[model samples]
Target: MDGDKSLFAWVVENYKDGHLICDDQSGETADFLHISASSRTLSFIHVKKSGSSSEQRKISASAHEVVIGQAVKNLIWMDFTALRTRLESPPIEEPACWNSGVKGSDRSAFLAAFDRRDATSRTEIIIVQPHVREAHYKHLHENGLDHEQISEDTLRLHLLEGLLNAARSTTTSVGADLFIIGSSD
Candidate 1:
């Protein structure tokens, strides 16, 4: 994640077309959904990002903590500085995360709900993106890169970006959200 926005492409590539479900009962390890409907469409669940203190506590205690790259070490072996440079310099068509000022929080509960194997498989991706801090955006502006022209999706993209940008060896596991896909397999 390097805290940069340009590195989001990789995250998107990795996550798209994958199965998403919540672990309502903490049953089986989550798996890919290679069945009908074939991901007909996707939507966002945007939540107002304020009073972050409670939000932080909620996510930290979430049943599943998506661990990336063998461990949290994914934060390491990263060129965050270089990533930042590219994000501000190119002023790519895609907006950088710095604009929204939303911090990354866990999306486990949303998935945990999917882990359930009952009649009501209710729950959808709630694109809860937080706003980026003003300071990060200020730093980008001072870099001589004019990103003021671009829009802001700083929050939703954080998770997607992280998934896309993660190294191949990196694995994102929602152990707490695992439930059997079918009656058997």
Candidate 2:
């Protein structure tokens, strides 16, 4: 597929500052993502199963919301070789923690390193981590979900509740919900 200009450039230019939520079972690997960022740079947030870390950048969630709004976008993983060809910049794969044979080289370590570099350089290696994967139940969980065609309504509600819980403690006011719960009548 052809790449988007604004989103692609934003993702390419600001990799280090993008949030990265490496779930407990997440594998050690890098990704090229299209996270919604208002600024030219990104503010990354990684919420692991055990706990989580603050965004690598100095921007506020409200600040980010103002610019990005509620636009749904795509974030896919592209290998190092492809980046070199597209950006016209020579490939420079510095020793990354995940494959570096270092301890705790999962999502957490990369987030930490990205945070440090993002702060110092104001720009570093691009790394994007989306909060939740957008897929239907059957598509998302593969064979884990019920075989019967699950309703999209059911899936959206389930994901929304989980997302709310995940974003509750976030400093960025990103999660926007427009629903009301009923009391036991």
Candidate 3:
């Protein structure tokens, strides 16, 4: 479950109980979409895996570029109306991205519940990057001091931290939350 696809599947399996989980991995949408009608929440999940050990230890700005970019760029899809329309008629035919979970009659009910939700509904962009160890982020911020003798990894993590902060700020401005889920190490 460490890989991107596996982690996505894991989310579907574990969180699909009371949610309309959509595996919209197509380039057109988020990697996975979780809609909880009861909670009135929609989560757009983007996933990425570390290519190297160093990347797993600290946030790699280059490695995160695509995932973060996708999360930000697809903010237009955060609308319930747009999402319902897209889900009602997905563009891709072969290997459909929104193929799994809450299909057929169930999808209608899910969409109905979604439509019932109001402006207070919460939406969030979740970036699940195991590559970015949480410890590195906390240490860098908590122990902020002279970076004169900082290692390459620390510098890169700092850069990625800045990027994540900027993304968070931007997401917040639009009445959405931006969450970066990294390893608790």
Candidate 1 lDDT score relative to the true structure: 0.27
Question: In what order do the candidates fall by lDDT, top score first?
Answer: 3, 2, 1
What is the TM-score ranking, best to worst?
Answer: 3, 2, 1
| Top candidate, metric lDDT | 3
Per-candidate local distance difference test: 0.27, 0.29, 0.68
State the RMSD for candidate 3: 3.9
Error of 3 at 47 (Å): 1.5
Error of 1 at 88 (Å): 47
Best by TM-score: 3
TM-score on alpha carbons, each prediction: 0.19, 0.21, 0.77
Clashing pairs in 2: 15-126, 15-127, 18-44, 19-44, 19-45
- Model 1 sits at a Cα RMSD from the real structure of 20.3
TM-score pick, better of 2 and 3: 3
Off by over 4 Å in 1: 1-21, 25-168, 171-185
